[model samples]
Target: DQQVKQNSPSLSVQEGRISILNCDYTNSMFDYFLWYKKYPAEGPTFLISISSIKDKNEDGRFTVFLNKSAKHLSLHIVPSQPGDSAVYFCAASEGRGSNYKLTFGKGTLLTVNP
Candidate 1:
């Protein structure tokens, strides 16, 4: 079973609008959640992350909100631009870097129309 799930396979938004991507998880052991953005041919780049202890984390125009009790998380991009179009992924880990592996969601393709 996929511990991390992005129910929406894709999303489309107009430039300067807000783009929201949602994710869900089944594993309660997950203590950390991360969001990554991937271009066509490059690898996924880390965008932001939140610990189970915090409900929100933000970096510039990107903000990630975590609802621990609901096992849900979402990434929000303000003033979305065409360059922001990419595949967004949600990842979860058990908080142990030494031996833990991150579980990734299928991914949500975001299209920011110019």
Candidate 2:
């Protein structure tokens, strides 16, 4: 079973619109949640994160909400721009410890058309 899954492999939206990405996890032990954005070849860069302690976290143009009971998380980008076109990955890990290993979902590729 996939511990983490991004059901949509890709999303496309017009520029200056809202882009939403969804993610789901089955592991209840995951306490740290993160979202990363990746360009063509470079590694993913951290976008935002929310601990199991919080239900929401937001960055400049990005926002993440976590629903612990449902084991679901979503990323929202308001007024999405062309630069936002890339693959987004949802990651999860346990609290800092030896067992802490970052697990990533396949990814959702978002394309913003101008």
Candidate 3:
């Protein structure tokens, strides 16, 4: 039933500022979006992706945005530092291959309070 939702489990920013992370999906057949970080030991990696026909996508400072009719998606980190904190997983898939399965969202603990 949880087609993916990271309803602000946690988020604190400071270091350099700017760190917005949010994701929601009711499964509109998705399209593609991924943003993983996870660090406290190392695992999740990725860290940027968006393809729902393209709403926005960057890499340098990390940026990903998609609003396929408001299914919602976001991940922006500008000056945020402190190793970029961790725990940020919001994945989805429904393209590029047909069925690899990737629907995750239950992570959003990005704390970078220098």
Candidate 4:
């Protein structure tokens, strides 16, 4: 069974608009959430991550929000640009330690129209 899920398979946004990607998890044990961005023919790179202890985390133009009670999380990109277009994967881990297994969602393709 997939523990993490990205309901929207794709999202299209105009350049300079805000792009929001949503994710949900069935596992309550998850304590950490991570978002990865992948470009065509390239490896997925870590974009931003949030710990369950906090409701939100921000880095540059990207921000991630966690709602533990709802078992949901979302990533927001401000002033979306063509360069920001990519497949975004939502990942989660049971704990912060090394032994925890990571679970990943299928990913949501984000297209920023310029």
Q: For candidate 3, lDDT tens digit of each residue in 1-83?
A: 88989999999989998999999999998888899998887789897898898999999998988988989989999989989
TM-score of 3: 0.33
Report the lDDT of model 3 for residue 89: 95
TM-score ranking, high to low: 1, 4, 2, 3
Q: Give the TM-score of candidate 2.
A: 0.96
Candidates' C-alpha lDDT = 0.96, 0.95, 0.91, 0.96
Residue ranges of candidate 3 with Cα displaced over 4 Å? 1-14, 17-31, 34-49, 52-56, 59-76, 81-87, 95-102
The predicted structure with the larger TM-score, 1 or 2, is 1
By summed lDDT, which 10 consecutive residues of candidate 4 come out lowest?
Answer: 93-102
Write model 4 residue lDDT over 1-114, tens digit each, in one string: 999999999999999999999999999989999999999999999999999999999999999999999999999999899999899999999986668778999999999999
Model 1, global lDDT: 0.96
lDDT string, candidate 1, 19-39, tens digits? 999999999999999999999
Task: Tell me which residue pairs clash in candidate 2.
Answer: none
Per-model TM-score versus the true fold: 0.98, 0.96, 0.33, 0.97
Best by TM-score: 1
Q: Write the per-residue lDDT of candidate 2 for residues 1-110, one digit (tens) a residue.
A: 78999999999999999999999999999999999999998999989999999999888889999999999999999989999999999999967788688999999999
Spell out the clash pairs found in candidate 3.
none
* Poorly placed runs, candidate 1 (over 4 Å): none
Candidate 4 stretches greater than 4 Å from native: none
